[model samples]
Target: MVCIRCKMVLKDELTKLGLHYTVVELGEVEVVENISVQQHDQLKAGLLKWGLELMDDKKSVLIQKIKNVIVELVHYSEEPLTINFSEFLSSKLNHDYTYLSNLFSEVQGITIEKFIITHKIERVKELLVYNELNLTQIAALLHYSSVAHLSTQFKKTTGLTPSHFKQLKEKRRSMLDDV
Candidate 1:
């Protein structure tokens, strides 16, 4: 799960299946009772119907957790991170940065840094479309070193300058999940 609606769907499905859940945070859930095989199958089917999957493996779960952390940080959190991203991610997931980086690259076919850049650019596009924050403010909010850095990245990623992208009639932006 990556969004609130996904959590709601999971909660609804669990209730319908007569399961009690203690927690349903993004990418993780904790049920009160041990689920029977039938309940597990029903829950999996229900989630699948809504385009979600039940990840039973450790590696897949960890990957989802990493994604959830990035999504929450980029799209939801307003506070800036105190430490460097590698340190922060390593501490948050309680694994060495090298391990996480390797596993993420091996499984996702992209480096973690690339994943972060993609999401940051997506967020920048979102801010530009909103038209509330100027380029400098957007850069600051997204932790860019300067507006020039943000512009360079935005141009490199989208093949259009931020101002040009903003002025376009279509105002194209990708979904968070797609990013």
Candidate 2:
């Protein structure tokens, strides 16, 4: 789960399955009762119907947690981080940065830094399409060193300058899950 709607769908499915959940945050859920095998299968099938998967493995759950943290930080949080992203991610996930990076790379076939860059660029594109924040403000909000850096990254990732991309008739932006 990566968005509110996903959470809603999960909650609805749990309710329909007669399960009581204490919490249903992004990428995690805590049920009040121990799930039976039948309930588990039903829940999995329900989630799959909505294009969601119930991850049972430790590695897949960890990867989803990493993604949820990044998605929350990039798309939802308004406050800036006091520490750098690597340290922050390590601390948040309670694992060494090297281990997290290696596992993420080995499983996802991309480095964690690359994942962050891709998400950041996608956020920048969303902000540009909104047309509310200027380039400088967008850069500051996204924690870029400067507008020049943001512009360079935007252009490099999309093969189009921010201004050019914004001025086009079709404003192309990717879905957060797809990013």
Candidate 3:
């Protein structure tokens, strides 16, 4: 689960199944009691119907957590991050940066840095479409050193300059999950 709506769906499903949850945040859910296999299967099936998966594998769950963090940072954060991203992720996940990076790459077939870049670019697209902020503000908001650097990254990722993308009649933006 990467978004609030996903959490809501999970909460509704769990409630319908009569499972009390202590919390449902991002990629995790804390149920109040142990459930039977049938209940687990039922929950899984219900989640699947809503286009969500009940993750059981530890590695997959870790990957989801990583994705959730990125999504939250890119899409929801109000200010630019102050510290290094790897350090932040390492501290948040309680693992070494190198180990987390390696596991993320091994499971997701992409480096964590690459994933961050992708999501950041997607966020830039979203901001561009909204037309609420200009390139300079966007660059600063996203923690880029300068607008030129943001422009370079935007062009490299999308094959169009940010201004060009904004002027186009049809702008194609990826959903957060697709990213």
Clashes of 2: 0
Q: Which is superior by lDDT, 1 or 2?
A: 1
Q: Which stretches of candidate 3 lie over 4 Å from their true place?
A: 170-179
- Residue-wise lDDT of candidate 3 within 1-179, one digit each (tens)? 87779999999999999999999999999999999899999999999999999999988988888899898998888776679999899898988989889999998899998899999899998998888999999988888899999999999989999999987724444444356
Candidate 2 segments whose C-alpha is farther than 4 A from its true place: 170-179
lDDT of all predictions: 0.92, 0.90, 0.90
Residue-wise lDDT of candidate 1 within 63-175, one digit each (tens)?
99999899899999889998998999999999999999999999999999889899999999899888899999999999899999999999999999999988772434444
What TM-score, over all chains together, does every model reach? Answer: 0.92, 0.92, 0.92
Per-residue lDDT of candidate 2, residues 37-148 (tens digit): 9999999999999999999999999999999899899998879999998899999989998998889999999988888889999999898888899999999999898999
Off by over 4 Å in 1: 170-179
The model with the greatest lDDT is 1
Model 2 global lDDT (CA atoms, 0 to 1) = 0.90
Model 3 has an lDDT value of 0.90
Residue 81, candidate 2: Cα error in Å is 1.0
